[model samples]
Target: MDANFAFLRLPDPRLYRRSNLTFSLLFLIKFGVKSFKFNTRLKMQEKLVAAKYEISRAVKADLAAITRIYNASVLEQNATATLRPVSIEEREAWFDAHEAANRPIYVLREICDANLTSEDGETFEADCERKFDSKGANLGAQKPSVTNPKGEILAWGSLSDYHPREGYRITAKISVYVAPEARGKGLGGRLVNFILENAPKFGVKNIVALIFSSNAASLNLFAKFGFARWGELPEVCDMGGKIESLTILGKKLG
Candidate 1:
């Protein structure tokens, strides 16, 4: 495979927890056999369900979805600096810049399971009303079973070369974008962690993040991982006539 485009997104850990709990409770209630004995089996099954989505190297085929995900962020005016939607053709060179070892792009996708059913003893339909638990957990019983189920990239992260100079090769910039519906559920954190663990393998000694100063969530997310302020660029972006600043953060890998 062309290694440059093979890095794909991994599943959000938060979804795994939700999937585990849903499967466990449903199986217990459906079979009417409640006991601790099923805990192991439930866990095993949960892993299988969670495995539907995976993290791997991005591939040439994923550029469209990646573009859409990035465009979504751009239109929202919170994450990326781009102000207009970009076409896949425009991003081709950008995608080409990523290599497996030095710079890589990863995506997260949901693999549909056709036979999956919901907890309410009913099958999921395209137009069916979704059921939720008292705590607002989605109790819908179907895994995405559409054609090219994995085509829908839920989130993505990347390691970008920080500077063109050879002296800056050891440092890289990090970025993570989660689908709007999937935000605030720990998916972004999971992607950041994924890149952190793999970045050193690519010879990265320091990871930097440039975030909008007004984005509290992104700021806190990086801070949680020990990334501290390195510098700032004042009034760098005009977000709808409002001047916004950018915060630079860095985390050195030991």
Candidate 2:
């Protein structure tokens, strides 16, 4: 009877060992599935960020962030026209003007991990790519990071009231700038690029960019985008101790 009891105790130890093994196998299977899912999501995000860039309208809530960037440009010696910094109130007013006209302010930013696109173009949605007369770009759908995406108060190519008349409404004096932190990332080009494509939609036929001759980077960008030498204001401005000519470059944004 003692031997029988000892044998039964041995079987109890075996049963406990089997139960532990079963739990370990199940845990490994569950962990592996979760890890794979996590890795797949991460990879998907990477592919999206790499696909391309896009442009869209800016919003009112974006006012503060856009103002911070624009003020930096104003404070810089080489970036803007006037020496005084623009207040947020002034910027907001400018934004309101664009809003009145239904014009847009746009930005070139990486789409966030969460995507919300609808076929009907609802709630700040955009296309995944666009055709450029030059090399094609993968400019994915992106909304403007500012309230006035098409206005000059921020980082955009703005028309300074072209001719100030009705017949000449098709023509507009435009200005463009990138935030201090946004330069050198092909933003200047992307900005004018997206704006040019958008001109016809806004009834803008001829577009103009007034650039200081010393601003070689901007000049080249304009030239690459097909802006021709249409006009100039000779040596009327001195910027940073340099007497610079104001070159007016024009583009047929048909």
Candidate 3:
């Protein structure tokens, strides 16, 4: 064969084997990565289930716990624009504004079983009993009944009207606040899921979240739920002179 024709000859057998081995290695690597991701997700979901949490509509009795959680955010984090802690009385009025049929507040609580014991060997039942007996006395008739024992509230979420105008009735703004101690436990994701699932039932078509641009955690949480960054206002919030920007994320539901 001529020199030019020699270059087009059949490839070496060794090269074929090497290419096959390289392809096999690449396939295994890709499969391993996918498997690892799926297993990690499964473990996270299992941990959430084992934590024994329940989400329910907020009640008049839960305003205190809800207020306490929000106040913690105000003091420790830039999650809200408020610089100072709010009073229970103020939160009570805010809670009254949430109409259950339209706009509602939901609380996530840790369910404590009577038979469960803590790491320190203290029975949760006895601890709850002591708390109820002492604190319940002050609450008087406002104390919850045994059949509907109040659990420790870990987080709260709400859907508020985006605007008062009739044309804006279909859009609502969402907010989620997790207690400082409960951060990184997937409570935020749970609340967001619940909110999106139920928003359509109350005539809401679009949900928006006004998050701080610097708050990557909150921004990512909403993004995972298919929310897109629709708009932003630079330097709109003077959060204690920190000069924070706001990111408006929105999602439309079917």
Best by lDDT: 3
How many residue pairs collide in each prediction? 15, 13, 0
- Deviation in angstroms for 96 in model 1? 0.6
| Better-scoring candidate (lDDT), 1 or 2 | 1
Error of 3 at 205 (Å): 0.4
RMSD of 1: 21.5
Worst ten in a row by lDDT for model 2: 122-131
Candidate 1 per-residue lDDT, tens place, 1-254, comes to: 67855787788999999999999989978777434334544444454334455566787778887887788899989888888899999888888878633599998764434443434444432321234568874432234445344534667899998998888989999999876655655767778888999998888999999999999999999999999999999999998786889999999999
RMSD of each: 21.5, 10.3, 16.9
Model 1, TM vs. native: 0.68
The TM-score of candidate 3 is: 0.69
- TM-scores for all predictions: 0.68, 0.61, 0.69
lDDT per residue as tens, model 2, 1-254: 99887766345678888999999999999999778666565555446545445556666666665677666666775556766777778888988877776556664444433453333333332232322334442223233346433222224445445665678868766666666534566767777777787778778888888778777887888899888999899987766575778888898864
Candidate 2 local lDDT, residue 80: 64
Q: What is the lDDT of residue 250 in candidate 2?
A: 90
Error of 2 at 101 (Å): 3.7
